[model samples]
Target chain A: MSQTHVVPTRVYYTIFAILMFCTYLTVQVAFLDLGALNTVAALAIAVFKAVLVVLFFMHVKYSTRLTWVVVIGGAFWLGILLALTMTDYLSRAWGTFG
Target chain B: MLPDAVEHHHPALAHQFDSLAQQREAAALGMWVFLVTEVLFFGGLFATYAVYRWWYPDAFAAASHELDILLGGTNTAVLITSSLTMALAVHSAQLGRRRLLLLFLIATMALGCVFLGIKGVEYYHKFVEHHVPGPGFEFEAAYARQAQIFFSLYFIMTGLHAVHMIIGIGIMLAMFWMSWRGRITADYYNPIEVSGLYWHFVDIVWIFLFPLLYLIGRHA
Candidate 1:
């Protein structure tokens, strides 16, 4: 008799509100004069929002660690693919033509 | 031995499983595996975007800057809200709150429609601006060739995502009807849970998409 633990309804609703606000904040980051830091700031905000969604929206935070593994594994693999590929592509002309 | 008397058991279930709960877990894991493949699919497209953005930095930035931040940001808000509604819908199903589940599902679909509508407007703007890639598609001279590449990735990535949105909407319609017909109960609500996962995955995709397509080259 395994019982799943569900989050309290109010908590879930509160997380949703916070996620909406975070998404709005990502947009607001654009209007700031961060200069070269704008991209960094925007991406950092996006990551924060993504964390909130994964933790609360998905309920992975309360689930078994195996569930978290599946998710983090998927994301980490994608990171690897993007990183290794860009290493070649972004550095193609680093010391050469221009 | 039918326990056809059992409230939750269906004849379709295989005997190996102890309960519908096990079956549902297997089904969910299968769906997640399918989603892994989906990751690889979009992975290819993102790789292409990265290569092109780096190769033609100026053009990519200019194209991104042309994007309406209001539209992009609004859509981001719309999508995150939809994900919230989706999560709520699943929560309702878990709690056996049928009416609440229906309400959340409808809310999710409405928000989804808003996203596509805004996207349609953006596409229309692109058409009017001749930013679409192909013949008769023109751009400022400094970024003529690469800008087209940028739009090419733009259309392809977001276009595929839009197609998925349409499919998700269709699925939601079917789920809504089934729920209305009393086919789904708290005990047999795996369909809703599965749909929620798909919806969340789409939201996650857009989470990445906002940065790649709308933010990456903007400051350039």
Candidate 2:
């Protein structure tokens, strides 16, 4: 295990702390009047935070490519599910229907 | 053996697995699957939120403003700390630091309790203001039923996440006791690591939940 695992503990934690602070900044940015860009900004920061969790906290950085595929595959399928469902759900023309 | 001592898989494998590598793979894979399900589960709520936001944008925004940003932000920080401790707990197990393992487990559990306690306080605030949405739930006339829908989803989504937190605390408590008995170690720490996975996934869920429930479109 020692021979194979190369990243030091401090590096992992430093990145974790950095990602957390970025998340905090994203949260604080919500208080400002960003108008139409508010959701976009929060979600962009969220994706960054999710990447940090996946890479470091969950050891994806140290995991095999196969493992990364498994993890990413889950995320991909989730996106598909969300996309298909929301297309139908959101596109319902309210007053157009009799 | 206690009832909880159901099976360890094999004597050569700590009665929990056919082999160390297999046990590790199974535990990690199982957690991934569970997390996928959770994604779908919470995805439903997120979809509902988006749909409702489209329909009742003002009401949803108004109700979101009612959420105490202090509690939400503090809870986010608290949960991130707990995740840090949880990752550290797994690291201690990997390094075979038995005492440190217990310490981190206790620390993680304590942080989890703080999260639930804060959430309980938030729920109490909601209750005092009649934010709990249902048949008798009160809503200002401007909202009609839309604001109530927002609160209904809020309670259900956050309430379900809170239930996961309580279960997470229980898992950590059990692991703490097991650690006391020398059951968890570098070689046989799959369960510990898996519990950390669950805890971290829960933390990740809240990561998104916080932004969606509290932060999205609130800059009006």
Candidate 3:
């Protein structure tokens, strides 16, 4: 039987701390007037927190290459959905077709 | 040679599989595929949300201020902590620490319940404020129609997330029972690990949902 990797308890605690800190930061940043940067700042913190969770909590960091492929593929598909849909929506205001 | 052959026949090993590692890998792969589908499922709603938010940025922002960030932020912390406990539970199962495994499982469930409880409170506030998206819906007159669209997306997205949390709690409860009866051991803990993946995925959804729903339009 192959041995499974056991993550240390301290690692979980550290990630938890960082996640909480980021949560606080996102909430605080939201109240500030950063113009267009507000949305960008919030999403950036969220993406960072999600990476921490995926790598540590989900153990994708320790997962096999196949698993990594699946994870990236999922995100890539979502990107495709967003990109194609947004292109049509954003271009609607450019001008109506003759 | 006989003993070696017998060692290969672990009860958890199916007849089709040559080895335990193969079985475990197959199961993990299957779960990942399912999770990929789940991502797309939620992805559609996110796409719809983004489209509307882009079209009606001002109204969306004005409507978002109605939500309680304090409660939303608190729930984010709660859910993230639950993810931590769930991760630790999987770790304990790997190490064959049955007691710690059970402890963390229950901890994770308790935190999940806290999150739902807080969500319920938020929903109640929404109802009291006439934020439900039908005829009784209330908002500033100028932004009323567009704001209703915002709240509609809010309810659908967050409500779907809450349903997933309830299902995850049910799964954890079953895992708790299995662990208590010694059904889960270090050698056969795939159930725990896979379920941990589900729970963590749910948490990841909320990690994105919180900022998208609560933080983005607050300043408006």
Task: Give me the candidate number with maximum TM-score.
Answer: 3
Residue range with the least summed lDDT across 10 consecutive positions in model 1 chain B = B4-13
lDDT of 1 by residue, A1-98 (tens): 33455677787678777767766776666666677677678767767777777777766687555667777777788888889999998777878975
List, for all models, the DockQ compared with the true complex.
0.46, 0.47, 0.77
Note the Cα lDDT for every prediction shown.
0.80, 0.81, 0.91
Candidate 3 Cα outliers beyond 4 Å, as residue runs: A96-98
Candidate 2 lDDT for residue B193: 77
Clashing pairs in 1: none
For candidate 2, write residues B106-182 as lDDT tens digits: 99999999999999999999899888886667767898488898888889888889999999999999999998999
Instruction: Give model 2's docking category.
Output: acceptable
Compute the interface RMSD for candidate 3. 1.2
lDDT tens digits, residues B70-186, model 1?
798789889988988888888887777889989999999999999999999999999999999999788889888898999999999999999989999999998899888876766
Candidate 2 whole-model C-alpha lDDT, 0 to 1: 0.81
Clashing pairs in 3: none
List, residue by residue over A1-98, the lDDT tens digit for candidate 3: 86677788899999999999999999989989999899899889988998898888888898889989998999899899989999999999889666
Ranking by lDDT: 3, 2, 1
DockQ (C-alpha) of model 2? 0.47
Q: Is candidate 2 or candidate 3 better by TM-score?
A: 3
Best candidate (score: DockQ): 3
